[model samples]
Target: MRNFWGLMRAYWFSSSWKEAWTLTVVIALLTALSSKAGVWFAEASGELINSIAFFHDAANTTPLTSLLENAAFLVGLVVIKDAGITGSRTYISATLHRRWRAWLDNRFNEALLDANHSHFHAQHGAGTPAPDNIDQRVQESIKDMTGGAIGLAMGVMAVATSLYFVGQKLISSSTEVAGLEFLGSYGSAVLAFVAVAVYVPLNTWIAVKLGGMLEQLSIRMQRAEGSYRGELTTLLRRSFHVAASRGEDVQKAMHERLYVDIDQTWGRHNIVSASYASFERVYNFVGARIVAYGPGLIPFVHNRIDLKGYITGAELVNALISQCSWFIHVMPAIATLRANSKRVIEVAVAIENVQKPDEFYRRTGRSEFRRTSQNPVFGLTIQNLELAHEGHDTTPFLAIDQLRFRRGEWIFLRGESGCGKTSLLKAINGLWPYGRGTIVLPEGVKSFYAAQDVRLPQVSLKEQVCLPDAPKDHSDARVAAALHKAGLGEFIEHLGDVTRQGKGWDQQLSGGQKQKLVVARILLQQPGLLFLDEASAALDPEGKIAFHQAIKDNCPNATVVSIMHEATPPRSASGTEFYDSVVTIADGTVIKKPLQPPLPAEITEILNRPAMRQPTRSPAMEEGWRRIARLRLKQK
Candidate 1:
C-alpha cells in the first residue's frame, strides 16, 4: 500500500498532474450531473402518470398539463447531459492515461541507467541471462500499470458516490410511517448492508489473487522471450559450424519453455475472468432489487395525500436503471485498481534499491588512495588494485599489482579464452565496480573502449558511426574515407547514394561491416588511448594491415593496447615500432621473454619474403625435440 502511494506520487510531482487532476474533476462533475438528469426525467414522468390517475379518480376534472410539460423538458435535459458526460469522461481518461504513461517511461529509463553498472552487467553478462526482454517489461508492463492506476481511481470514486446517494435517499424514505414504506424498506436496509459487506470482501480477495498471477505471468513471459532471443543472437555471432555444435540444444529447450508458459498463462487468465464475471452478475442483481423496492418505503398511502402524493412510479423505475448500470460496469474498474497498486509497489522498491548512496565514498583511505590523478610518463597507472564482484562479500576475483602502460607504447593481454580479459578491459575503462586502487590517467587525454561484439543500432550504416548523439552533419565523403581506410570502401559504394539509400548504419551492415563501422567511429572520436578487444578479428590479414596503417596515419600519437590472437605483430615507423612493450599472459601469469616482433614491413610482405619462406618445422611437432635438447643441456 505504501509503495503504491509512492509510485502515484511520481505523477503528482510531474508537470502533467495539475492538468490531469483538473480534467478528472471536470469528468466527475459531468458524471454526477448526467446521473441526476436521468433521475429527474424519471421523476417527472412518474408525477405525470400520478396526476393523470388522480384526475381519472375524480371523474370530472381535466389532467394537470404542467406535469406533462415538465416531463418533456426533463427528457431533453437528460439527453444533453449524457452527451456532455460521455465526451468529457472519454477525453479526460485518455489524456490522463497517455500523460501518465509518458511520465512512467521517463522514470523507468532514469532508473535503468542509474542502476549499479556492475550489478547490471553481472545479471545480464554474456551467456548468463538475456537483457533484451527486460526491455519489454520496462516498456509494456510499467506502462499498463501507470495508465490503469488513473482509470481505476476515477472509476472507484464514481461508483462509491453513486452507492452513497442511493443509500441516503433510501434510508430517508424508509423512516416514514408504517404500511407500504415500512414493509418495502424494512428488509432493504439489511439486504443492502449484507450485499455491500459480502461483495466488497470477495472483490478485494479475487482482485489481489489475480494481481499476483499477472505479476508471475509477466516475469515468465519476459524469460521465455529472452531465452529465444538469446539463442538467436548467439547463433548469429558464431560461425555456423561452431554454433551448430552447441547452440541447437539450448535453442530447442528455450522454445519448449516458451510454449509451456503460454499454455499455463491462458488457463490462468480464463479462470480469473470467469470468477470476475460471476460475482459481477450477483452484485448487479442485488442493486436492481434495492432500487425497485426503494419507493415502497416512501408511504404512498397517506389518507389526505394518497399513494401518488407520497411517491411517484417514475422515481422507482429511474433509480433501478441508474443503480444497475453503475453496479455492473464498476467491478472490472475495482479489480484494475488493486492490480495496479501491486505493480506500483514493485517499481517503488526497485527505485529505492537503485538510489541508495554508495559506501565507498565514506571510507577514509578510499579518498586519498583512489583519487584519479594525471600521469605524464605512463598513460595510466594502477596502484595496489583489487577487484571484486558487485553486491557480494566474497574474496577478490583478480588483482593487478602496480602496473603501468607508458605513453605512446602498446601492450597486449594474451591469455586463455575465459581468463577475465574482457573484465580487465571494463575495469580499465571505469565501467565496473569500485576497487581498492589508485588510477592515474594522463592529463587531458580521452579514451575509448571498443568491445568484441559491437552494438549495431537500427539506423543506416552512416548514423551508427556517430551514435548516442547525432553528429553535427554527416558527410558521405568523410564516411567513404573512413570506410576505405577500414577496407570497406567497396561495400559502402555498393550500398549506393549511402544517405537516402541506407537506413542509418546498423540495418544495412553485416557483422564485418559493423566492425568496420565501429573502427570508423573510433577514428572519428580519436581518443588518446584506444582499448580494442579483438576489434580487428573480423577482417582478413590484408584488411587488418590496412586498418592498422590507417590508425597510425589518422591518429599517430594515440597508444593502442589490444587483445590479439595473431602469431605476427604490428610494424614500426622510423626505426621505432608502435608497440614498444608486450604484456603477454599464459595460464594467468605473464611471460617474461620478449616475442620476435613483426618484420619492419607489411605482414603479407614479411610472410612472402624468401628468408621467411625457408623450410620450417611445425611448432607442435618440434616440442619433443626441444624437450630432449633441454634435458641434455641440464645433464651437462
Candidate 2:
C-alpha cells in the first residue's frame, strides 16, 4: 500500500504535474456539470408531463404555452450536456493522452537509463534481475494507467453529482399516500440508500475478485506476446545462422510452444471475461428495476397513486428517469473503476519495485557497491578491486590489489573466453555494480566503449556513424573520410539512404561490416579514453591490423584499451611500438608487462617517414620532450 502511494506521488509530482492537474480539474468540472444537466433534464421532463396532463384534464386551468416553453428548455439542456461531455472525453483522449505519455516515457527512461540508479539492464545473474516485458510495461501498461486513472476519476465525479441531484429531487417531491406515513416524502431517497448499501459491498467483492484475475491474465498475455516477439527478433537477426545449422525445425517448435501457451492463457482470460459479463448483465437488469419501482409500487398497491389520472404521467416519468440514472451514471462507473484500478496498481507496483535498491538487495541477497565520483586526476587508478557474479561467493571472477595507468598510455588487455575481460570493462565503465572496488579516473573524462556487437539505429548512415553526438557537429567530408579509413569506402554514396530502409541496420550489414562501422564511429568521436572489447573480432587479420594502425594514427593522444582473445603482431615499426604495455588476465588475477621500445633502426625508419613526424602526440608529451631537449642542450 505504501508502495502504491509512492508510485502515485512520483508521477503526480513529476515535472508535468501542473499541466496534468489542470487537465484533470477541467475534466472533473465538465463531468459534474454534465451530470447536473442530465438530472435537471429528467426533472424538467417529469414536470412537463405533469403540466400536459393538467392542461388535458382541465384546459382552462393550466396554460399550454408554459408546457411548450418547458419542453424547449429541456431539449436545449440535453444538447448542451451531451456536447460538453463529448468535448471533455475527446480532449482527455487526445491532448491529455499525449502529454501524460510523454511525461511517463521520460520518467521511465530516467529510472531505467540513469547511470546511478538504473537496474533495468542489470545482468540476470548480477545484482537484480531486470523486469520482464519492459516494452509492454512502458507502452501498454502506461496507457492503461493514464486512461484508467482518468476514467475512474470522471466516473466517480459523475456518480456523486447524480446521487446528490437525484436524491434531493426524490426527497423533496415525494408525499404520503394511502395512510402509509413511512412511504411518504423522502421515501424514494431512503429506499435508494438502503439498496445501494446492500449492492455496493456485494458487487464490489465480485468486481475485486474479477479484477485480480484480469490483472494476472494481463501479465500472462504480455509474457506470451513478448516471448513470441523475442523469438521472431532472433530469427530475423540470425537468419543466416539458423539456415546454415538447419535449425528451422527447432525454431518452429519454439514458436509452436509459445502459441500454445498464448492460447491457453487467453482461454482462461475469456472464461473470466464471460463470467463478469454474465453477472453484470443480470445484476444491472434486476437491480435497476427494483431501485426504480420499489418506492412507486408501494403507493400504487396501497391505492394512492393511480394510472390514467393527472398524477400518473409524473409518477411514471419519475420511475423511468430514476432507472435510467442508475444505468447511465452509476453501474458502469463502478465496474470500470474496479478493473482499471487493478491494472494501474499492478503497473505502479512494478515501477516502484524496479526503482528501489532495497528490493534489489532483498531479492538477490547480495550487497551492491555504491558508485562514487572524485576530483579529477591524471590517468586511471584501481585499489583492491574485487568482482564476482551476483549471488555467488565462490572464487571471484576478477581480482586485483592495485593497478594504475598513466595518461596517454596505449594498453592491450588479453584474456581467453569467459575470463572476465568484458566484465572488467563493464565494471570500469560503471555499468556493473555487483562488485567491490574503487576505480578512479580523471574526472569528467569522456570515454567510449565499442562492443563486439554494434547496435545501429534505424536512421540514415550519416546519423548512425555520428551517433551519441549530433550529425551537425561533424561535416559530411569528415564522416566520409572516417568511413573510407575504416574500409567502407563503397558505402559513401549510400549515406543518404536510410539503413535497411529505416527497419534496422542489423539486417542490412554483415557482422564484419558492423565491426568496421563501430571502429569508424570511435575514430570519428575521438574520445580521451577508448575501450574496445574485441571490436575487431569479425575482421580478417589484415583488416584488424589496418584498423588498429588507423586508431593509432587517427587518435594518438587517446588512451586505448583493447581486449582481445588473439593478439596480432604489428607489421610496421610504428605499429609494433604503438602499445606501451600489455596486461594478461588469468585465473582471476592480472599480470602487466611494459613493452620494449622500438630499436634504433626502426626509429630511424619512422623518422624518415614524413607522415610520422606530424606530431600527433598530446601537448603533455610535447612539453616533456621539450624539457628533455633543454636538459641535453645544457649538458652540451
Candidate 3:
C-alpha cells in the first residue's frame, strides 16, 4: 500500500510540482461541486416529483404553472452545470494524464541516456536482472499510475461532500433514528457516523480481501503480456535472421509457449475477478441498498425522502465507497498498476542512481586522471589491469601488466577470436569492472567506441552519421565529405533522406555497407580517444584497408585502438607506418611489437553494397550529380 501510494503521488514531487498541485486542486474543487450538485438534485427533484404527483389537488397551494416553470428551469440548470463543470473536469483530468505520462517518459529517457550510460549498466550490471518489457510497462501501467490515484483522491473528496450534505439533511430535518423507524419508535442517529463506522469498513474489508487475490493474478497477467510482447518484438527485430534459418516452426513453438503463459495468466485472473465481481461489487452494492432502504420503509421517512432522497444520499455514500468499489469499473487498472509498479520503478531507481554495489562487483582498479593545477594525463595508461566477466571473476581471462599510449598513436589490438580482446576494450572503456588494476584515462577526452555490433536508430541517414550528436548541427558538406571518404559516396546524394516504407537501415544495408557507415561516424565524431572493437570485420578486404586509410586521413590527431582478429592482422593501407604498436594477447600472455608490412597480394574482394534498389534518376538528375563530382575533383 505504501509503495502504491508513493508511486502514484511521486509525480507531485517532481520538477513539475507546481503544475501537479494546481491540477490536483482544480480536480478536487470540481469533485466537491459535483458532489454538492448530486444532493441538490436529489432534494429538488424529490420536491418536483411531489408537486407533480398532486397537481390538481385542492390542498396543493402550489399552482401547476409555477411548478412547471420550476421544473424546466431546474433541469436546464442541472444540465448546464454538468456541461460546464463535468466537461472542464474531464478535460483537465485528460490533460494531467498526458502531462504526467510525458513527464515520466522524459524522466525515464533522460536517466537512461545520461552521461554515465545508466541504461547500459542497468541491463548488464551485476545485480537483480534488469526490468523486462520496459516499453510495455511504460505504456500499459503508467496510464493508471497517475490517473487512477488522482481519480481515487477526487472520489474521496466527493464522497466526503456527499456525506456531509446528505447526512445533514437526514439529521436536521427528519424524526431522527437517522430517519428510520425501529420498534415502533424513533431516536436520533448519526447516519454519517454509522455508514463510516459500519458500512464503509465492511465494504472496504470485503473489497481488499477479494481484490488482494486478484492483484496477484493481475500481476501475473501483466507479466505474461509484457513477456509475450517483448519476445514478439525481439523476433520481429531479428526477423531476417529467423527467416534465413527457416526457423518459423521453432519460432512458432517458442511463441506458443509464451502465449500459453498469457492464456493461463488470463484464466487465473478471470477466476479471481469473477469471484470479486459477484461478491464484492454486485452483492455488496445490492446489500447496501437493502440496508439503506430500511429508513424508507418507515412511513415518515418514506414520505420525506421518497425515492429521490435515497438516490441523492447514495451519491454521497458512493463517493466514499467508490474508492473500494472501484473494482467494478477499473479492477484491471488497479491490478496493472500493482504489477507494473515494480517494473517501472526498477528502471527509474536504477537509472536515477547507481545500484548499491553487490558481492559480484570487485573492480577497484579503474582510475581516471582528474584535472588538477597542471594538465591531466595526455593519454590512456594501464597498470596491472586484469579482465573477467561480471559473474565469473574467479577466472581472469586476460591481464595487462603495463601498457601506455600517448596522444596521436594508432594502436592495433591483435588476438585470436574469443581471446578476451573485446573484454579488454570494454574494461578500458569502463564497461567491464570484474577484475583488478588501474586504467588511467586522459581527463576530459572526447571518446567513441564502435562495438562489433552497434545498433543504430531508425533515423535519417544524416542523423545516423551524426549520432551521439545532433545531425542538424552538422553541415551537409562536411557530412557528405565524410560519407564519400568512407566509400559510401553512393548514399551522399540522399544523405538527408531517411528509410522509407518500413524498410529501416537494418533491412536495407548489407554488412559491409553498415561498417562503412560506422567509418563515416568515426570521421564525423573525431573523438580524442577511439576504440574500434572489430568494427570493420564485416567489410571486404579493400573496404577494411580503405577504412584505416580514411581514419588516418580525417582524424589524424586522435588516438585509435583497433581490435584485429588472428585471421586478420592490422594493416596500414597507405604503407606510411600508421600503426605505432601491435599488442597481441594470447594464452594469458601479451606480445607488443611493430612488424614490417606484408607484400601486396592478389586481393580480389571489392566493396559489398546493400540490397536496396537505387533510386531511379532522370537523365538530368544523373548529369547534376556528375557535374558536382567533376567540380569537386577540379577544385581539389
| Per-candidate total of colliding backbone pairs | 9, 0, 1
Model 2, residue 86: C-alpha shift (Å): 3.4
Question: Candidate 3 lDDT, tens digit per residue, 1-636?
Answer: 125566677789987999989988898888777766665665666656666766877987767875887598678768955897788888988888889888877777776677776777667545556677667666667765667655656656766666666566655544434334462222322443454457656666666766677778877777788888888888977888999999999999999999999998788778877776676656456545654444344433535445444443444444434433444445445655566676677667655445332222433323222212212345888888766655542567787788877788888888777888887887777676567677777777788898777676778888989987898779999899989999989888877677845578766777788888998998988887899888988877777788888888888778888886545454665555667878888997677776444432211111112321237767776556545545554576
Between candidates 1 and 3, the one scoring higher on TM-score is 3
Worst 10 residues of 1 by lDDT: 360-369
Model 3, runs deviating above 4 Å:
1-6, 61-74, 178-197, 284-289, 299-332, 352-378, 391-393, 570-578, 599-636
Query: What lDDT would candidate 3 get against the real structure?
Result: 0.68
Error of 2 at 607 (Å): 29
- In lDDT terms, which candidate is top? 3
Error of 2 at 401 (Å): 2.8
Model 1, residue 388: C-alpha shift (Å): 4.4
Instruction: Give the TM-score comparing model 3 with the true structure, all chains together.
Output: 0.83
Candidate 1 collision pairs: 181-297, 300-307, 459-504, 459-505, 460-503, 460-504, 460-505, 461-504, 461-505
- In model 1, the runs with Cα more than 4 Å from the true position are 15-17, 38-78, 114-132, 160-253, 290-348, 355-371, 375-377, 388-397, 473-481, 489-507, 567-578, 587-636
lDDT string, candidate 1, 351-384, tens digits:
4443432343222112123547585556777777
lDDT of 2 by residue, 495-556 (tens): 77785555566668888999888878988998878898888888887878887888888987
Q: Which has the higher lDDT value, candidate number 1 or candidate number 2?
A: 2
Comparison by lDDT, 2 against 3, better one: 3
